[model samples]
Target: MAITRRHLLQGGAVAAMAPALGLNTNVSAIGTAHAQSAPDGLKWRHGVSTFGDIKYPADFKRYDYVNPDAPKGGVVRMFELGTFDNFNLVVDGLKGSLADGVRLISETLTTRSLDEPSTAYGLLAEAAAYPDDFSYVIYRLRAAARWHDGKPVTSDDVIYSFEVMKKNSPMYSTYYQHIVKAEQVGDREIKFTFDGPGNRELPSIAGELPVLPKHWWEGNDPQGRKRDVTATTLEIPLGSGPYRVKEFVASRSVVLERVPDYWGKDVPVSVGKNNFEQIRYEFFRDDTVGREAFKGDQLDWFTERSGKQWSTAYDFPAVSDKRVIKEKFVNSSSGGMQGYAFNLRRPLFADVRLRRAFNFAYDWETSDRLLSNGEYHRDNSYFDGIAEFMATGLPEGAELKILESLRDKVPAELFTTPYKNPVGGNDDAARNNLREATRLLKEAGFETRDRKLVDAAGQPVSVEFLSQAQGDERSILFYKPYLERLGITVNIRTVDSVQYQNRLRSFDFDIVTTVWGQSLSPGNEQRDFFGSESADRPGSRNIPGIKNPAVDALIERIIFAKDRADLVASCKALDRVLLWNAYVVPQFAGGFQRAARWDRFSRPEPLPKYGVSGFPTLWWWDTAKAAKTGGRS
Candidate 1:
């Protein structure tokens, strides 16, 4: 499935977004192997994992994190920041703003367990088989899976989805780049052949292929205009998931109704989820307006991103009287780097020393204290929340060995010194950090002339911080003075979301606040974040435009990791390299999911450790509570 605009609206962290659906289709067979039988050296299984650990067995019941018998009739009116002009998943991120929660209408071959670190169970696919080397993966589609139009999902739909998505979306293209071909070996089975072997993540990622309805995309609309999968359209596409588009208004709102006779409703993974009868997303220009809407009862749920607002904004009567709830959910996944990413495509940001100087000049301590009410922690590593994968102290053991192998290409300081951000809170500390930043800038061939920093050619050094959110503008304003003190002219350009995205896609900005969300088991996504190939790719997540061979090699190590330990060491090495190079000026992490919702919903106890408040998914309507709070049901 395409990267949803919701993720981008929430500060570009893809990790918190819902999983993309997967689909598979038929093609010419590579061999004579039957779908019932595994190929010579391959083994058929109900699910796939990053490592070899599979939590829920084949005959297991629904996921332990859900309420199996929970009531499910309610309307979830959520606020979506920014307008959406498109519902077409294929062209999302590249063409127009994607409608929020659009991914709910599609189902992948396999659905990842919210509780597991990196594991997926069959949803559309009944069973999957892969060889020891993982050169290819074969998925057997469930005959029971049916599109909303009462048509059975087939191998053709999956194949079409794979080819279309890989060709159109840069994110999907990079993600599925390894899968060289797709073939149908059985009536209901599809096979995905990878570029090579030894990449354990291929099988799992292949299962995440978003299936599309070929018949709908290839057919005509109500006015008889031919549907184009490559182009954006308002025509509602057919889906196989539990929810389908009920009604929508361009750039304003969209409502999805639960499929009454949903074919996959009885599936183990679907047992306790998709509780809302109608999921409505109302668009707003920004979160401030959205928060106001929530207060006025126009929105049912509100996810607070601003720490200051989270700390002080919800003193309204609803919260006071328990009609609304404010709670923090533990975030177990890695808090991947969210920072002011330097656009290396810009010649002005080419020097590592200058990037490091920018980091020194940032007074995160004071910023957190004043702007966020001291609610956030400064990000020290690319993988902050995850302890095992984070590079700390000095590299040793397996991580040392991995770094040693790339010593010639990486910064030598990484081996000798432990990476730490400059600390600043008091005036003296801030002054000291600014002095260090000035020294570093001077060393990078910049000179303070006429109270302005100038380069070798005497051109004044300046930077434009491009942002889409008011919160980001405020943060930039806070740091602008610090940069100005270093004799560097700072410009904060606050554009709308669309303009901001366009600037990011074209790498047209000097710096932008963005995020690279990380999964517990880091894999091919690393390539999109730091690999050389994605550095120049327009729509890729490599916002920093990193093109280091060392980073690329480390990404491969993480991808082809032989075991859990190997993966950890490889990730640590990559983290150390990124921190040492200073591709971004580290920002603050909330460390929790700050959310406020109407108190008419109830969730399963001890929610999945990794799910991070599975809102509206693991939750269901509570009639008694709804009646008390005057909530819709």
Candidate 2:
């Protein structure tokens, strides 16, 4: 059952036979399938498998779901955790979602652009006008905006949100840390002054800044609340969003019913949305039982990770009759990269050749076939999706334009450096790369003796791959074999979520197979992952403990970039630098997202892109249409 990246690549050759033997007729043929069954006692069962708490309505679709009827009645059961033991609020990574549920009830001055047109627009603030000078950011709050408690939202409240967040959540406070002052100019207008060009980026920053109520807690402390606040259920909390907490039952469920009189109900963003009258989130201790709940109609939607379950589970006769739908979206990895990362601070992994050696030794194609069921595409460059620098082969003019745009941020030498062209299969590239790695190891003062890579002291070079116990069995199996051929001994140990975080914080493991979410803006925020100063910090994501002057400098260039071209160039440069350093072994990117949902609901008009959450901002769920699906409760 154990597999490594090498095994997966090797298995790809065998997996190709599926079509030859008439095995894989379509997506449903080789993998387990899923579908909704007859409704049980629960109205809807929306289940999911996640390692962390289910903080909905924040970044997730909970904010997208709306009940048009505005019914005072039903509950929308959901699955997720309340808090992760190793939770962090740093701007770079996953912490933003933790505070999302609360954010759903609250309002921010601005909200980041999801699609294209309104990339950085105001939410609480009516308008954010930036003049050509871009000296100061003028924030205009909507006069109609008010807290759920009916208190008017004003400039003072906006100022207070900044003050409280800076003192309470420093990790998430990176946006406002540079603000000089926020002065109320008029009844509905406020101005935030920054040092220089920082003001030009105010729209981008202000859009993400969530507004807090100034009058709610005049004297209550922000930090003290974060440390002492542990509520298993709904404690009286007020928000300025569309929904308010109705009830909370610890370890059982939580319900949030829509506010009938939510302000700005007719706003462009609010139109034709909020289909669900009430949204409920429920918890389950096990994934199998969770899947069963969906089959029993305890949930409405579910996303499964196990290809085995997808290929096998849906055949239940109950599911067959219901006509539940199974769907897959491509290039939907959400910029997530899953690979083997080494702690560069360790001496054994200091050599770039060793890292490349590992890259050549392990095979991504094979890993996908065996573990992911051939549902993934191996990635070469770090840039995925719309990032412009991802082009592998370019002509002279295009190369010049790209180079000219990136010259200020990346090294000039990169113009001549060849792009890592797409790899087709187990070919000569691997052999040449292995030979190159061997040469680099020799040059770096290492040699293979007695079939083992050892330093001058003759100490064997070894690495321990730390992983979470839940679903890393396949990842461990995929990596072990390739490491063996490189004269490196691999040790994989699966630890619980909490234990894994604890060890990662201390840099106790040599290597870790982890997920790094590539953001729309990729820049210096990566400090948490590869920065020198963040190495020992418990919350910092920089597990590699890599400290390179070149990397640090490039990170600064990318973050402070003024335009998209510069940003892309910096990213390409950074990607090349990281690849040259061999800090991470590139793995699979652009994988499939498989989810099963009831076919009752229908999309209205324009469908949102793949990365968007299906919610109030995107579509309306029609109960009448859903009822016609012939499902028995």
Q: Candidate 2 — what's its lDDT?
A: 0.52
Query: Could you give the C-alpha RMSD of every candidate to the true structure, in order shown?
Result: 4.5, 12.9
Q: Per-residue lDDT of 14-92 in model 1, one digit per residue for the tens?
A: 3432221121111111122233566554656886766444568777779988899988798889877777777888887
lDDT of 1 at 580: 96
lDDT of 2 by residue, 62-168 (tens): 22333333323233444442212211222212222122233356666654322221133346765554433435566667788988878898889877666655555
Give the number of the best model, judged by lDDT.
1
Which ranges of candidate 1 are over 4 A from the true structure?
Answer: 1-36, 39-42
- Candidate lDDT scores, in order, read 0.82, 0.52
TM-scores for all candidates: the values are 0.95, 0.73
